[model samples]
Target: MPVSLVILAAGQGTRMNSDLPKVLHQVAAAPLLHHAMQAGLSLDPEKLVVVTGHGAEAVAKAARAYDARCDTVMQAEQLGTGHAVAQAMPLLAGMAGDCFVLYGDTPFIRPETLEAMLAARARHAVVVLGFEARDPGRYGRLIAEGEALQRIVEFKDATDEERAITLCNSGVICADTAVLADLVSAIGNSNAAGEYYLTDIVEIARKRGLSAGVVICDEAETLGVNTRAQLAEAEAAFQARARAEALDNGVTLTAPETVFFALDTHVGRDAIIGPNVIFGPGVTIESGAEILAFCHLTGCHVSRGATVGPFARLRPGAELAEDVHVGNFVEIKNAILDEGVKVGHLTYLGDADVGEHTNIGAGTVTCNYDGVNKHRTKIGKRAFIGSDTMLVAPVTVGDGAMTGSGSVITENVPAEAVALGRAKQVTKPGLAPKLFDMYKAAKAKRQKDQA
Candidate 1:
């Protein structure tokens, strides 16, 4: 059977205390809502609908970034879960397959858990994701009869015994599209909150003689971020899972807890990651690559056997070929370092192409931008860039060419040529003491004048 997904992102999240929408806040270097969307993408749903309310435009934009095929609906009012989901009804109208409802604020949901819910739909009309919470507290209780879920009772409305139930509703529900639409339509605002609750659909299904089921998942999978503190907690949880996964996949992490990974970071087996490394979006480390401590990489690829710094930054468009060495305090952006290239510490290589086996010395810089225009620098194979050399943009260093130390190169250097851009050396002998005596006489005359 085909499946679709409806993501609810209509909450105000006033507790977050920021102008940005709550769902837009990042966990593991990605928007929380994006994480939810990624989990759903694994299922290859036919239709993905994101319902936005607070910060509607921004939230919708973020949603589309993850899945361009995503359709968005607006919930103009902050009513309740049922009302929020109903906003997507028009899009779900003609579909008869299973439709899963996910929360944008709850981003740790796993694909396997969603698959379990969809699987249970084969035997039940409604399937609700639940968790055995250590402290159920105010969460809605999931009343189950064997594998069948009898009802969902909110804590405030439940009796003492019901409230004690540890199997709590995680607010993730899946049902046939038509059944979900019908059940949500029938839910009324008759409770103390005067809001239509999606949980009511469970009892409504039971009343219609439709069997309901529950798929139990980890409580951590249902964590919702409503404040800064919760966001931090979510980030920590995401890191723990990502680190463990990296280790399980045969990658090495020197200090697992200190490293952070983005949503799309990919590290092949045998890659080594040091402590305090942060991977932003679109980073890939091939097998045998070593990334040292305190490095940050984003939108870059480290090829096999490449080594990156203890304090390097790889910005967007940076690519390191096999055996490339990018030392500490180096930053590479919009550049490609070919195989066997060695770039030592304290250098900036941007908008440049460095050929194979090129050795770039410390304090070297490719002046790529001038006022408004950005230019490129090409360093041919085996080229040597001396320390403190500034290779002005639109310049090229041919194969086997070398530049003198502290040289300011504004033009090309031919193949195998040595480019010396510094001024002629000159010295004045026996002048230091004479200059000091003159300075002392002047100082003495000035002091007498002042007295």
Candidate 2:
């Protein structure tokens, strides 16, 4: 059967203590709602509806960025979970498929677990995700008989015996679209919290003589982020899982705990990453690549056998071909370093293209941006850019050409030619002492006058 997802992102999350919406806060360099959408999208659902409340505009914008097909509805009031789900019914109307309700703050739900929940629908009319909480403290209890769930009792309302049950509701549920619509409409807010509870659907289904079951998952999968500390904890948990997966896939991390990865970081087998390397949004390392410590990379691609530095920054659009070497303190932006290209320390190569076997010496900078416009600097194969050389944009160095050290190149150099753009040296022998005498006398006269 086809499936649709209704994500509840209506909570204000006042505990987060930030101007940004809680779901919009980043974990692993992505919003929490985006993470939830990723898990639900794996099922290839027919429709996706995100219910937004606080900071709805920003939250909706982020949702569309991840899945352009995602539709959004607004929950003007924070009436509770059932009211949040009800706002999505108009969008899902006439859609004949199973609907899965998920929480935006809970992002670690695995695709396999969701698949199992859908499978459970074959035997039960409603399926709620349940977890065996180690400390069932204040969570809602899932009351069940055998494999069939009888009802869900909130901790405030549950009796002492019921509260002792370790099984808790995760607030994720799967049910037929038509059945869920009916159940949500029949719900009333008369409990201790005086809010419409999504869990009440279980009892409503039971009263109608329909069966409700549950799919069990690890407690970690239901972790909800509500504060800065909890967000950090979630990030740590995600990194642990990412590092373990990377190790199992044959990637080596010199110091795994010190390294942080973005949600979309991809490293091929045999890639080695050193300590304190932070990968931002779009990074890919091909097999045999080595990234040294303290390197930060984002939106860049490193090909086979490439070596990036101990203090390198590869910004968006930077591409390193096979056997390329980018050394310490070098920043590359919107540039391509071809195979066998060598860019050493203290260089900035932005909006430029270097051909195969080219050597970019220390302090070499491609002056790509003028006061008004940005341009490209092109260097051909085997060209040598000497130390402290500045290649002003709209300039090109032909194949096998060389530029003198400290040269400021403004025009093209022909193939196999040497370009020296510095002024001729002139020396006055034995003049150092006279110059020092003059300076000393001026300093003494100025001091005497002041006194």
Candidate 3:
């Protein structure tokens, strides 16, 4: 059956004590909404809707940024979960297939868990995701007989026997689109909290003789972020899982705990990541590439056999081809280094392209920006850039060209040519001794006069 996703992101998360929407807060260098959307995307749902309320604009922007096809609807009021899901009904009007309700603050729901919920739909009309919480702790209780769920009772409304049930509702549910709409519309806010509870759907479904089922998942998979401490815990959990997955996929981490990965970071098998290496979004390290300790990389690609710094930064648009060596203290931004290019210590290459086999000496810089605008520097194959050479922007060094150390290259150099743009040296004999004696005598005279 076709599937649709309705993600709830309208919670103000007042417990978080921040102006930023709870869904916009990041774990693993990505917004929590992204993680939720990523899990939903795995289902390839035909329609995706995000119900927004608190900080709706910001939440909508983040949702669209992660998936442009995502549709966002505003709840307008801080109603209950049932009201939140009701807001998405208009978007799903006449849409066939099942609708899976997800929570934005819950980022750890596994794709497999959702698949299990879908499998349960074959036997029941309503399926609710549940977990055996280590401590039920005020969570809604799922009254069930084996896999057959009878009803859900909020901790506040639950009787002593119901409260004793260890099975807790995760607030995630799956049902046919039309059935969900009807049940949500029939819901009333006459409970203890006077709020429409999505959990009521289970009892209502059972009243109509439609089967209600429960799909149990790990307790960790239902971890929800509500405050700063929980956010920190979520980050730690994400990192632990990412590290374990990398190890299982044949990537080598010299210090696994010291390495952090972003949501979209991809390191191929055989890639070696050293300690304290932080990866930001949009990074890909091909197989056999080595990223040394203390390196920060974002929006870059490192091809096979490339080795990056023990203390280097690769900014957005940086691309290192096969066998490229970018050594310590080097920073590359918006540049591409072809195969066999060596850019050793203390260099900054930005908005430039270096051809194959080029040797960039220490302290070399591509002066790409001129206060107002940015320009590009192009260095051809086999070119030699001497130490301390500054290639001013809008310049090119042809193939096999060599520049003298301390050169300020503002113009192009032809192939096979040696360019030297420095002031000629002129020496004056005995000038240093004479100047020193004059200065010392003057100093003595001044001291005597002062005395």
Candidate 4:
């Protein structure tokens, strides 16, 4: 069955005490809204809509950045969740599928949980996600018998008996797109809060002889961030889960708690990640790759058998092929190091390509930026770049070439050639002591004048 998602992101989150929209706040290095959208995206939804209010433009941009096909609608007023869903119905008009109402602040909803709700749609007209809360607190209570959910009672409007129910609503619902649009249209805001509640759809559907069901998930999966403290807790929760999953999948984390993972970090089996390694968005380490402690990697790929530093940064577009070794204090950006490339300490290879088995000595730099435009440096196979060698931009060292130490290479070196672009040393006899004597005389004169 085709699926569609309507994510509610219109809340101001005043408790968060920030001008940024609540859903734009990050967890796992990605906006909270992206997490919700990622779960929905796993279902390959036919249509995706985000209802935005506070910081609508920023939120809409973030949504489209994640999925360009996503459509965003403006919710000018903070009416309620039902009103928020209503705003997206027009965008989803004539779409035939199960429409899921998701909360942007809830970032822990698993894809399997949503699939379960879709499966439950086989027997009921509406399926609401419910959790057995450890502390129900102010959450709406789910009134259900077995798998059949009778109605949902808001804590503000619930009787004392209903308030005592431990099963709480998670604000995640799935129903037929047409049926959801109709149910939302029929909802009214006459209750305690005088807000149109999406929960009310249950009672309205039940009264119309349509059945409603509950799909239960872990209490942790229903965590919603509303405040600064809750945001911290959410971040911790995401890290804990990510670390555990990495360990379970055969990836080695020397210190799991100290390693923080972004939303889209992918490490293959047998890969070793040392302590305090932070993975930013779009990093992938293939099997047997070793990332040492204190290495921060973002938007880079480390191939099999590649080893990165104890203190190194791989910025966007940095790619290391199999068996490449990048040592400490090395920064690579917009560069590719082919197989068997050894780039040791104190090197910056940006906008360059090093061929297989090439050795880059310490303090070697590809001066890629010429103050106005960036250029490329290409080092062919088996080349040797001597220490402190500066390969100026738009230069190439050919196969089996060797560069002299402290050389500044401005032109290309042909295959099997040696390039040396430094001035020859000249010997000076008895010049050091004479210069020191003159310096001492000048110092004495300056001291006498000051007196």
Candidate 5:
């Protein structure tokens, strides 16, 4: 049977206290809706429909960046979840398939949970993900009658006893498209808010005497973010999960709580990560690579046995080959440092390429950006860059080239040559005593005049 995924992103999420759409808020360096889209795409669904409302243009545009082929539906009015899904009804226009309805604000919803719910499929029935929480709140309470879901009763619509049920509704449901279409049709805006909640479908299913089952998962997996505090909580949860996975893969994190990893970051076995390091997505560190504290690395590759700083920043396009050493206060962006290269202390290497066995001294900078466009600097094998030297871009230091301390090199140096570009020293032989006497006389005369 064909399966489709619909993500509802219709609400303004006013509680988040920001103008940006709730789905656009980032978690783990990716927007929340991107996470939802990634999970949906992993399902290999026949069709993926995104329902946008409040920030329709922005959200639709962002979604297109990720998957241009995805179909978008707009809810002109902010009614409720049922109305949001109703917007997507046209995408399912002629196709009869099972559709998994998801929320854009719930970025942490796992693909496995969706797959499990899909696997636990029963034709002609509703399957909603559920969790047993301490407080059900405004969420619909999942009341089950011994393995069978009795009904999802909301707080206002639930009895005192039913309201007290610990299992809370996750608002994620999988249903036969035709059955879901029928369920949406029967739902009326008769509730307290007068808004059509899709949660009403479970009760409607029960009233129709149909089988509605609950797919019980850990409550954390379904904790939707509606505010900044909840968003922070969700971020913490994602970080914790990523750290645990890293440790399980033989990577050791000292003070794991202080480290953050993007969802797609790949770390090899035995890589040690210290506190306060942020690994953005597309970062991959090979085995024996050690990344110390206070490092923010994104879109970089750290090869085997390499050591990155206790305070290094490796920006996008940085590649540190095996045994490379990048020390504190070094920022490398769009640069490649070959094996045995040591870039230590107070250096910025942007749009540069350094060959193997090179030593990039402290306070050295590749003047890569010229205010308008960027240029590249190349350092050959065994080249020694002296401290406090600036190698203007479009320049190259050949193999075994030695740059004198404090020299500014604008032109390329030939292989095995020493490039020392500095003003020649001119010294005067001792006129020091005569100059000192004149200064003493002048000082005395000035003092006498003042008196």
Candidate 6:
């Protein structure tokens, strides 16, 4: 049977107090809603529907960044949970499989729990995924009798006894696709919140003699964010999990808590990550590579045995080959450094390629952007670019070539040749001191006349 996931992202999230949709807030370098989509993807749903409201345009834009062909369902009016799911019904018009509904704000939900619920789903309908909470004060109460659930009583409607019940609801359930469509239609928006809740279907199912099964999961897996504080907590949780995974993969982090990993970063075995490193998406570090403290890498690759900065920045399209050393204050973007390359202190190499065993000296900069367009600077093998040199692109330094310090190379240098382009040095002794004394003597004369 096919499975279609209906992700609810239509809520305005007033509690977040920001114009940007709460789902777009990042956790581990990706949006929270995108993380929820990953959980949905894990189940391999046949189709996906993202219901959008509030910032509909922005939400739809974010959906484009995720996998699966997403159809945006417009919830023009902020009615209720049932209404939000109802808007997605048109997207699932011809679908015959189970329709799995999930909240976008619930980013930490584990795929294992969803798989468990699917496994427990029955032939026609099954309202599953619940747990006995240690503190169920704010959650809806789950009233189960024997092997079946009686009803999930909302907190507002529940009496004192039901309110004290420890068995709480997770609000994540799967049912027959057609049966769910009909059940959602029957839910009326006559409750305290004036919103037609999907949870009402649980009680309606019990009344119709349909069995409501229960599948329990760790409560932590169901945590959702509604405010900035909650967002911070979610970020901390995600980072913690990411660090733990990196450690388990044979990557040694000096201070795991100080290291931040993106959701899709790949680290090879025996790689060492120093403290306070921030890894953005698409970053991959090969085995035996060492990244020193305060390094920020985004969409880049570090080859085996390569050593990156104590303070280096590697932007998108940056690739460092084996045994490459990018020392402190080196920023590389859209550049490739071949094996045994050493790009030492304070350099910027963007849209360029540095050859094998090349020594790029301190403060050397490849001025790639010439006001209007970006140009490439190519350096051949064993080339030596001297300290404080500026290669104004589009320029090339040939194999075994050497450049003098403080030189500004406008033209390409031939193989085995030396290039030096700088202002001629001249000395003027005593002139500087004579000028200073003249100014001081004038000031003294003026002060004496005034007295």
Task: Tell me model 4's lDDT, rounded to 2 decimals.
Answer: 0.97
Error of 2 at 327 (Å): 0.6
Task: Give the RMSD in angstroms, all C-alphas superposed, for model 1.
Answer: 2.0
User: What is candidate 5's TM-score against the reference?
Assistant: 0.91
If both were scored by lDDT, which would come out higher, candidate 2 or candidate 3?
Answer: 3
Candidate 4 regions exceeding 4 Å error are 430-451
Structure candidate 2, residue pairs in collision: none
Regions of candidate 1 where Cα sits further than 4 Å from its true position: 433-451
RMSD of each: 2.0, 1.7, 1.8, 1.8, 3.1, 2.6
Identify the runs in model 2 with alpha carbons over 4 angstroms from their true place: 440-451
Candidate 6, after superposition: displacement of residue 183 in Å?
A: 2.0
**Model 4: per-residue Cα lDDT over 157-215, one tens digit each:** 99999999999999999999999999999999999889999999999999999999999
Question: Candidate 3 at 369: error in angstroms?
Answer: 1.3
**Model 1 — TM-score against the truth?**
0.96
Q: Please provide, for model 3 over 1-451, each residue's C-alpha lDDT reduced to its tens digit, 9 standing for 90 to 100.
A: 8999999999999999999999999999999999999999999999999999989999999999999999999999877999999999999999999999999999999999999999999999999999999999999999899999999999999899888889999999999999999999989999898998999999899999999999999999999999999999999999999999999999999999999999999999999999999999999999999999999999999999999999999999999999999999999999999999999999999999999999999999999999999999999999999999999999999999999999999999999899999999999997999999999999999999999
lDDT values of the candidates? 0.95, 0.95, 0.96, 0.97, 0.89, 0.88
Q: TM-score of every model?
A: 0.96, 0.96, 0.96, 0.96, 0.91, 0.92
Lowest lDDT 10-residue stretch of candidate 2:
18-27
Worst 10 residues of 3 by lDDT: 75-84
Q: What does candidate 1's lDDT look like per residue over 259-344, in tens digits?
A: 99998999999999999999999999999999999999999999999999989999999999999999999999999999999998
Candidate 2: tens digits of C-alpha lDDT, residues 222-265:
99999999999999999998999999999999999999999889
How far off is residue 442 in model 6, in Å? 8.6
Deviation in Å, model 5, residue 315 alpha carbon:
0.8
- Alpha-carbon deviation at 407 in model 1, angstroms: 1.4
